[model samples]
Target: MSHPTADRARQLLDLHTQPEILVLPNVWDVVSAQVVAATPGVHALATASHSIASTFGYPDGERIPLDLHLDMVRRIVQAVSLPVSMDMESGYGHPGDTARRAIEIGVVGGNLEDGMRPLGEAVAAVQAVMDAGRAAGVDFVLNARTDAALRADPQAPRSSVIEEVITRGRAFLDAGAPVVFVPGLVARDEIQEVSDAFGPRKLTLISVPGASLPARELQALGVSRLSTGPFTQRVALTALQDAAAEIVAGGTLPAGTRPLN
Candidate 1:
């Protein structure tokens, strides 16, 4: 039972030369994972906690049980040939045990957010988890996420944002994170500043909206990875809602609207 896909994912992390950003599209289920894998140059696939939780009729705040989350990861790995990365929200347990379990289940890498935890403690937790995975003979890419922008009010000062990201990122890197992800970033200057601060020592993953800069532009800014988060899931859900509303209002189904297979 050699897991070539899992091994390939670990190798992909080593294949980075420059920043050479890999834009990982987040998938909610097996079908979405398969479809994204069929696309050109998609090195790896990531799962969105928001998408997974919503699909199960639960909100995104860890309402879904650990058993359910592991099941989702197992099914996605079985469904796709590409390397799979999971959104293991807070690693699901104590750092060491959770990382060991995730590696055993075949998630090549994961995104762990430092949500409200002090920077030092979050870094230690991430390090412990990463060490556990490495000790299990699996190379794990712990993409530490700093949710400062997402958690803070829109009017929060720029100084606050910079300080928070820097402080948290330093801690996560010290703990052995291969990359740091900053979500909700929009401006080119901000992206550049963050990347510059991190430099070649670590990868900086950015989540950009479709309405924002194009993919080439993001890569030009030295983003090591770009993700869309749950945007695709949101789009799909919105379209379904629109069609359902039409049907409920005695209107015919839209011409291009086909039932999901």
Candidate 2:
């Protein structure tokens, strides 16, 4: 049976191929989602799992229960008119079950990372997601993350790290993930090398402090998608802390606060 949201899946995938890089602000809750959705002409919305877990008093990884995570994603979907993608970290078991849960929640696509798993294991997980999608007649977008660039030993040779990421990226594409996401490879040459190596295959880069390339420049370097993981959430939390401190000192409430339905 085809998933009810199969059409949305294709639409989300098309956005990535467009000339403009698909930039997802990566919200964690209904309020953050509403703020982005309210902006005129926003393309889509994506949830940052790390932010969601932290808000729920848990750390990253699958620290939050599957049901709870799905519930939050569902709420985000209900709150936004744009397509929403869940950051399904290592997935909540196998890739098929993860795909099932994500598609069931009305999300069009998701980010599936390798985490600490072996390369082959990660590739298998991506294939499992693809298999599930086929059985269900769905075409979900799998943004595969290879952590070798981010998690490998710093003393390792740059050539080896780049090769590992490239190799895993090739495997991920073979496994049916349309986009390869390699966070922490913010250097310009490294990003270019991956882009050149993959040729037509799309690359997703994380937007972080001290990124050697800007968003548009990354686009020029062949990056198809750019997302800020949990940086925005951290900024918000810091702002909230400052506001609370003022409130405790008898200062009036901040002016831009709005109520949500």
Candidate 3:
């Protein structure tokens, strides 16, 4: 019989190839995972490293210790039957080991950022994570990320940034990552350019506030996934802030509020 983790890994990979775009609302903890999983039409769950770190009072970029991060991830993995992919920011400088540990904790896939590292080094990091997954008998879905657009020079031409994203994205795909996540390029033309470069259902993008296109339009452009990275957490916090302000003004809690945890 196939292992459950391996099965889940395959399921996540398959989601990327389907005609519809896989939309993931990134989660931070067990409760968030449970809530998203319980929602109709959610096929998978992804963790936002930023959200997780902030919940623990730390900043993002892997500021939280690996063990603590893994512990929280384990709780989330156990909380839902859906495939869980972790945002392993730069792999804590040990891509292989980190991937292996995450796999052991039942995480079927992950996002590993290149952080604009040297091409060779970033390719090796992608390989390391995939190698770890292969050794563990799971077809890990590595959403290899390129920060080219995120770090692009404002004075540089937009075409140059698109080219950089395509270059890094192809390299990561060749390094065994099933999909390449290119964040920060929200314009329709830019997204279409990168999506065309990567071919059908192989490009993933982060959905931030004011994204130009809806999920269906992105799917029409051949983008495979649109994940809300840390935005969900921000939205939740905004609601809390609004409610707290109302309470201080002598208002009771919101009428429609109910228990989710």
Best by lDDT: 3
Ten contiguous residues minimizing lDDT sum, candidate 1: 201-210
Which sequence of candidate numbers ranks them by TM-score, best first? 3, 2, 1
lDDT for residue 58 in candidate 1, whole number 0-100 = 86
User: Candidate 1, residues 1-261: lDDT per residue as tens digits?
Assistant: 756645765765764434566777799888888888888988788888889988898888678887897788789888877777788878665767776777777777888877858777787878887887668777787788888766877788986887778777767777778888877666788777777776653545545555466767777877777777788788777887998999999997789854444
User: So what's the TM-score on candidate 1?
Assistant: 0.88
Better of 1 and 3 by TM-score: 3
lDDT for position 75 in model 2: 96
**lDDT of candidate 3 at residue 240, scale 0 to 100:** 98
Error of 3 at 187 (Å): 0.7
Model 3, runs deviating above 4 Å = none
Candidate 2 per-residue lDDT over residues 1-261, each given as its tens digit: 554478778788888899888888889999999998787756888889999999899999899987898899999998777888899998887767987878877887888889858878998999988787676667888888889898989899999999999999988988888898999889889899999887653899888866547888898888989888998898788788989999999997789876744
Q: What is the C-alpha lDDT of each candidate?
A: 0.76, 0.85, 0.94
TM-score of each: 0.88, 0.92, 0.98
Candidates, ranked, lDDT: 3, 2, 1
For all candidates, what are the clash counts? 1, 0, 0
